[model samples]
Target: MTAALVEEAVKKAAVAWINVGAGPARALWCLPVDGTLIVVSGPGEQTAPELPEATRATVRLRGDTGGLIVICETAVARIAPGSEDWAALAPQLAAKRLNASGTADDLVARWENDGCAIVRLTPATDQPAAAPALPDDAQAAPPRETPARVPVRRPFRLHRVRRR
Candidate 1:
């Protein structure tokens, strides 16, 4: 039942914010397939997650009432490109991509042509639902420093020309 709930929420939610290892949360386009959540990450894809070949992740979802729902203890892995599992999950993943440039087939081809990593996040074992906790340092990074003085440009005026 817990697994089903996790899968359902993942598929229904527009974005799944997952945290792998000690990294911060990342909102990604996720698809729940074969009892697991799959996410594509690359330069041009949804988000470039820091997940390696294998790791654990925590997925954050939403309930019907726009409340927080957390699916914890997820095992993460990067699927091999062009492998059987990757091919099977490609169409489903591509379909969920909002405003994808081309057809499902084309998207898969592009993912392959590019060095995109198709990451899979599945339940590590039998785990119950729980509320997610805020990170210790929840504040965003500081903005870049800029020069104190600023330059101002004068506005230009348009001149009317006489008709010939």
Candidate 2:
């Protein structure tokens, strides 16, 4: 379980990045509203998984020393455009999206025009409640979807391609 103070710290964070042991981590400008972390991602915004493809994911965040800050187990829900949740979260995301193509008034319009989804991640509601307090150190390792695997690229490979 995430403590109230930790959650507040997350709320204050301008961006949160999560990777489910996949290709790469995605960072989004998010707002923690009502205990739910609301994130918007798509082609023109932050990159995120399609989300609807997975029901649950382990989200990890690190503190100043790169320590785990409550490895959150969350249920992923994709909020479609034009819904009440989208209506509420879109404006905030747009305001925070520094590179958005249009003015604030045109943000939602741009999303609808581009086809984006508002994904909300909440503490997993199904599983048994977690320990009330998380270790405030490196004792916690991020949960992985699968066992460890080999790296996709060579660790000591040259920085640039060799001349032909």
Candidate 3:
């Protein structure tokens, strides 16, 4: 039952939250193909650090209402460039990628040249890690460390404009 649900969710959804190793879950655009979810990450693509080396990951799919639907563990496999799988799936991924910079063939060539990681996530379990009943606690994480910061003060106005 759970496996069927997972497959259904993957087929219907275009995005998923994936947590690899110790990193927090990151939302990624995904494509469902050959009964697995395909995600591209690296330069010029979504950021999923260490995913190529990861053997397993946790994937969460949300329903149309924007609520958590299911969380499941998946086995990770990296598809080699120029392989049969890559030749078949790359065009599809590029076509579905929103706001892509170039044509599907160009994107595929760039991905290969840039060493982008194209991984397939296959559901590994029939039972979900969490699902059906939502958890009470809000699963939010602290912002990642970065040099960027908000301005300390608002911009000074020469004079406040009075509104009618």
Best by lDDT: 3
Clashes of each: 0, 0, 0
Per-candidate TM equals 0.71, 0.65, 0.89
Residue-by-residue lDDT tens digits, candidate 3, 55-137: 99999898778878788889999999989999999999999988988799999999999999999999886578546455666
Give the alpha-carbon lDDT of every model. 0.74, 0.65, 0.88
Q: Clashing residue pairs, candidate 2? A: none
Q: What is the total number of backbone clashes in candidate 2?
A: 0
| Model 3 misplaced stretches (Cα beyond 4 Å) | 130-134, 160-164
Candidate 2 lDDT: 0.65
- Model 1 lDDT at residue 27: 67
Task: Give one digit per residue, the lDDT tens place, for model 1 in 1-164.
Answer: 66677767766766777776766667676777766788888868865557655477777777788766655678887888778988788888888788989899998989988888898887665774654443444335454345865668877659865789
- Can you give the lDDT of residue 36 in candidate 3? 85
Please give the ranking of all candidate structures by TM-score, highest first, separated by commas.
Answer: 3, 1, 2
lDDT score for residue 73 of model 3: 87
